[model samples]
Target: MNMGTRTDSRFMHLADIVKVNLELEQDWTGLAVHKSSPRGDGDCDGQKLLRPLLSGLPPKRLYIHPDDQIDMIKNLTGPGESETEWVLPLHQSENPTTISMLASLFDSLPNPPVPSRRKRIILASVHNDSTVVYYIVHDGLVKPRQN
Candidate 1:
């Protein structure tokens, strides 16, 4: 893809995603992570895929609805209870890169309290140890009560 030119301002932040992924590759051996490419099929109805680093998190639902959260809280002490995990499944099954990032559990931060854009980065120091993820987001909206 053309990496040398002025890109639209709308996608400016995503471009940083690409840049960080490339720069951080030096810390990882096989995992090739990048932000969703412009040509990516994410806009497709059922074509959502991960961007590598995010795939390493438990999976169930990223954003738990308020009602669901209350239901879960009501049953917090019950057995066989439902649990929530975040699975950042990336698209590498058909891609050339063999590094397919599957589900991973993170030990940082509480689950989402509201639905909004999530910008995150999973990083490690070395030896597959000392790992941490940082999530930064920007959103301002007055959510209407659906209940």
Candidate 2:
């Protein structure tokens, strides 16, 4: 970190989070909190792949249409056809200040927040900023979960 970084309001102050770059492709590498990644953890499982891939990109979009949802729900059950990873192309953006601010804000939370499909994807939130915050979203089910 540069000593003069304090002067820049848009710099990463608490950017302690480190990532592992798994992909050799120039467009995207991996990112994670751990120095070493777990085996068979899958591409979409950790920050190692998801973070840098989404850093400056738009809120993720679904490639399949609504009609396919019904088909998938009926036929693609019981894990015979699970996908390896759904690739979404991204454009780079920077938000050092926002990330730093978020780090401080979320530091107090005890539980590590898990990203479900609903909370993960944030479609239509893109603007002229360097990098915007993105969340996860899940596949829709006909009946809600009952415990």
Question: After TM-score superposition, what is the CA distance of residue 44 in candidate 1 from its true location, in Å?
Answer: 3.8
Model 2 spans > 4 angstroms off: 1-4, 7-11, 14-30, 33-68, 78-147
Instruction: Put down candidate 1 lDDT per residue, 77-102, tens digits, no spaces.
Output: 32332232222322222232232332
Residue 97 accuracy (lDDT) in model 2: 27
RMSD of each: 13.8, 15.7
| Model 2 poorest ten-residue lDDT run | 13-22
Candidate 2, residue 19: the lDDT equals: 9
Most accurate candidate by TM-score = 1
Considering only N, C-alpha and C atoms within 3 Å, which residue pairs clash in candidate 1?
50-89, 50-90, 56-104, 57-104, 58-86, 58-104
lDDT of 2 at 128: 45
Candidate 1 overall Cα lDDT vs. reference? 0.31
